[model samples]
Target: MNTRAGEAEAVDLQVQGRVAWRHAIRSLLAQPRGSIRMYSPDYADWGLGAPDVIAGLDAWAIGRSQTSVRMLGQRFEGLQRDDPRFVQWRIRFAHVIACHALPEECGGLQECLLLPEIGLLVIPSEKSRLAIYCSGARLHAAVHAFDQSWEHSTPMFPAHTLGL
Candidate 1:
């Protein structure tokens, strides 16, 4: 994706699968103020299938005022059972939103992050696996898909449980 705004440029990240995924998670963790929205098949099966990333996402919900939403594919059910992030966000009354659905639910994609004021759309390339941030109706539409899923999916706990 080309960076039309000049302020938001997609960085071509070059690293091993594990390293890149970890870096993405770390980036999400460091930015405590902004929100993180991701669509993945299963965190357990994903290359970044590590405990710390889950912990970090959990920490994000519990520690920050920001919102974090996860969109799980259809085959992904109860995948967040042991995830600290799921526990922290879903049960501990943290600021978070979680959702589950089939590939059709996610509008067909692996991962995405919708940043604040940046419009929408920061996707990882299939070949390069690098992150590309862009702005347009496309991102807006993807975010809409996220919103739809979040509204429709079941929470591990309850909305009132987290006061969300």
Candidate 2:
């Protein structure tokens, strides 16, 4: 479960089922000090909208003034209906959290959560409810890929929508 590559310490955990995935994600969320980046098709099944997770995110965002959370997804059409708590959390932390939609030209993107400063990476599978937690040098490639996708993404899921 733990390995070392060069000077970096690495830990890997393979988890199955929704409960396990949520636990893994919560654990990863607890480790970040500076930033968090996440990518998913729509985040509908990831349990990220759960109350506890939203509370944890709220705590994390307040832990530091410079902390930032970036989320990129293929689409988020149903997020407001499916994850109202998460929507509210986003609204409260609008200055700290940002959501983006991946452009069609970007093609397929694997679901992941990356904490670059902490060197942690989480890759999750929605259909099977499986996830892998990886750390250390392995994070480099995932971080790079995420950065590229983020660069091509457009703002989405705004905290507030203006109504006339």
Candidate 3:
């Protein structure tokens, strides 16, 4: 299914077809960090507990160069930020996006865009569909959407800051 097209039928198919999604994820993991820009609504629950990928992101964030991760409409936050492993993230640019506390039907509490070089991964919730893109223009459009929602949200403590 081509998630990029916003087709509900496509998303439903992909969610039920684990084998196909698994292969796509593996391909994503194989890419170099610079070649990928990951945007997800929830980093805490992603990748089925893949330690290597988690560690790699931590290491990458710590370098003098900047690495960006944006969170949109997040419903829950994870505990990694307090861990020393996430120190790099604190110093870098991490944008958390949310709505203005709307009810769940309006797309729930979280929606994220993980921008990797290969494409954008949209993980709004569990078993959600992921979108792939190779163009910056596509990514930029997603970013704009995130920003629009983010602007309406009142400031709240990031889940990490709440000692989650």
TM-scores, one per candidate: 0.53, 0.83, 0.46
lDDT value for candidate 2?
0.74
Q: List where candidate 1 sits over 4 angstroms from the true fold.
A: 1-16, 45-70, 75-78, 81-89, 103-107, 117-141, 148-164
Scored against the true structure, residue 72 in model 1 reaches a CA lDDT of 44
lDDT of 1: 0.50
lDDT of 1 by residue, 99-152 (tens): 555445445553555654332233455664444443455556667776776665
After the best TM-score superposition of candidate 2, give how far the Cα of residue 73 lies from its true spot, in angstroms. Answer: 0.6
How far is 124's C-alpha from truth in model 2 (Å)?
8.6
The regions of model 2 sitting more than 4 angstroms off are 4-7, 30-32, 63-67, 117-127
Every model's Cα RMSD, please?
A: 5.9, 2.8, 7.7
Error of 2 at 150 (Å): 0.5
> lDDT per residue, candidate 3, 80-129, as tens digits?
43333343333342432221232244443223333443343434435555
Model 3 TM-score relative to the real fold: 0.46
Runs in model 3 lying further than 4 Å from the true structure: 1-45, 64-67, 77-112, 121-130, 154-164
The total of clashing pairs for model 3 equals 15
Ranking by lDDT: 2, 1, 3
Candidate 1, poorest ten consecutive residues by summed lDDT: 116-125
